[model samples]
Target: MDYFLQLVLNGLFVGAFYALVALGYTMVYGIIKLLNFAHGDIYMVGGFVGFTMLTAASGAMGAKGGLLLLIVVMVLAMLTTGTLGLIIERIAYRPLRGAPRLSILITAVGASFALEYGIALAYGPNPRAYPVGMGTGSFNVFGVRISTGQLVMVVIAVILMIALDTLVRRTRSGRAMRAISQDPRACLLMGVNVDSVIARTFFLGSALAGAAGVMAGAYYGKIDFLMGFIIGLKAFTAAVIGGIGNIRGAVLGAIVLGLLESFGTAWLGSQWRDVFAFGFLILFLTVRPTGLLGERVTERV
Candidate 1:
């Protein structure tokens, strides 16, 4: 029972990361109908940006200011990545909006490569050790042990998710987002600034990914340029599983995927974790491609 509880707790923490990143995938897909393969690279950039900030400040603040420094660095990273997302969208994707889908997709892939290599060139190919971390203290609840770092990560993730949910459901900008998603041409005709709304969506999505990246670095204690690749694919799977264009579905899918990974790793060994994840993706695609919460939309011929 304790083991089961532990797995569940761990799954939730992992799910938080997936949820943050998956929201980006879902939002971009929802608004632009573009996959934004470069999104994960933005996540990688966030980690590196956090790493650089922490490294530069660690000596000045010492261990006494860890939490404050983390908060500051996270904000800075998010802003940096958010701006980067806007730039990518403006420079790479906007041009191809009227082009073939293949062209946009290829551009996305190219953008991903460009960001990955750009980071590698700047930071080197070696993995950098994170300068700061949430402490190792932990507590047990109902026989389940939870680390402080895990708890912090989960809490921050939940807060961000809730804030995003509110933003999407309660705000006028969110209404515009939904409008654009449903019909951009109509939105344009209705006097909506579709481009501005799309840019904001990318900014919000990328900022969340950035936050997740910082959290991952702080918890895992190491990061690399290529770290975002597999996780990007996993987040995409989560988005698909939850209904790609649905915000709530993205969160639900991430939790499901995380739980699956935790239990699968325990039962089948770590090496098989990716296989299990992707296998489930194939199963979902074959059996219910619209996903758990995705609505079926019939396009007009």
Candidate 2:
């Protein structure tokens, strides 16, 4: 039982990362119906940005100021990645908005490649050791050992998710987003600047991905340019599992995927983790394409 409980705790921590990244996927899909494949690269960018900042500051800040420095680095990384997301949406996606879906999708793929290679060109094709970490201190509760770093990461993730939820449910911008998602033409007719709203959506979503990236780097202790690729797909799977356009569904789906991976890893081996995750994705697509919380919408032909 203790072993099972430990797995569950670990799963929740892993799920926090998925939840952050998946929110971006769902938000972009919700607003413009575009699957920004490059979104994951934005996450990679965040990690690199955080890495750069930490590397520069680590010597001066020392261990005493580690927490404060980390907070500042995360904010800067989020801002940088958010701006990058806005640029991608404006330059890559906006031009192809009226074009066929396949065209935009290809462009998204191109953008992803561009970001990945661009980072590699700048940072080299080598894995970077994170300059800072959340320390290796842990405590046990009910015989389930939990790391402080994981607890901190989960708390921050939950706060961000809650803030996003409030924004979506209560803010005017969020209302515009929902409105555009339902009927962009109608929202445009109703005097909403659909383009601006879409841009904001991309910004916010990418910002969340950025936060996840920084957190992951701090926790895992290493990062690389291509790191976002697999995680990006996993996050997309999480979005789909929860219903692509539903905010709460994305979080729920992330937790579900995380738990699945945790238990699967324990049962099988770590080497089979990706296979387990993708396999479950295939199963979900086959059984319920709309997702657990996704509703079937009948579109006009």
Candidate 3:
């Protein structure tokens, strides 16, 4: 029972990271129905940004100011990645909005490779060690050990998710997003600037992913340019599992996937974790194409 509880704890922390990345995937899909395959690269950008910021800050701030420095690094990384996302949408996606879906998808793939190699060219193809480390300070709850760093990370994820939920449910911009999602033409007729809303959506979604990247780097202590690729696929699976267009569903699916991976790793050894995750994806797609909260909408011929 203690071992099971420990696995659950591990799953929750990892799930929080997955949820953050998945939120970005779901938000972009919800607004524009385009799967931004490049979104994961944006996450890799965040990790590097945070790493650079922390490395620079270490000389001046030292270990005493670690937490404070981390907070600043996270914000800076978010802003940088958010701007990059806006640029990608404007230069790559916006031009092809009226083009075929396949065209935009190919463009996204190109963008992903561009970002990945661009980072590699700049930072080299090697993994960099995260300068900041969470000291070994932990307490046990019901014979299950938990670290302070993991606790802090999970709390931050929860706070960000809640804030995003509130923004989407209560803000005017969110209303515009939903309006555009339902009918872009109608929203334009109703005096909404569809382009601006879409741009903002990309910015916000990318910013969240950037934040997640920083958190993951802090937790895992190593980062690389290609780190986002597999995680991006997993996050997309979570989005699909929870209903691609549903924000809350994305979080739900991520947590579920995280837990499944945890238990799978425990039972079948760590080697089969990815296989287990994808297996569930296949099961979900085959059994329930619409997902848990996704509704079927018939297209007009």
TM-score-superior candidate, 2 or 3? 2
lDDT (Cα atoms) of all candidates against the true structure: 0.92, 0.92, 0.91
lDDT of 2 by residue, 1-301 (tens): 9999999998888898899999999999998888889999999999999999899897776643476688789999999999999999999999888899899999999999999999999999999999989778999999999988898899899999999999999999999999999999999898999999999999999999999999889989999999999989999999989989999999999999999999999999999999999998999899998899999967778
What TM-score would each prediction reach against the true structure? 0.98, 0.98, 0.97
Instruction: Give the per-residue lDDT of model 1 (tens digit) for 131-171.
Output: 99988899989989999999988998999999999999999
lDDT by residue (tens digit), candidate 3, 144-183 = 9999889888888999899999999999999999888888
Q: Which pairs clash (backbone N, Cα, C closer than 3 Å) in model 1?
A: none
Distance from true location, Cα of 139 in model 2, Å: 0.5
What's the true lDDT of residue 56 in model 1?
80
Clashing pairs in model 3, backbone N/Cα/C closer than 3 A: none
lDDT of 2 at 101: 89
Clash totals, every prediction: 0, 0, 0
Q: Which stretches of candidate 3 lie above 4 Å from their native place?
A: 62-64
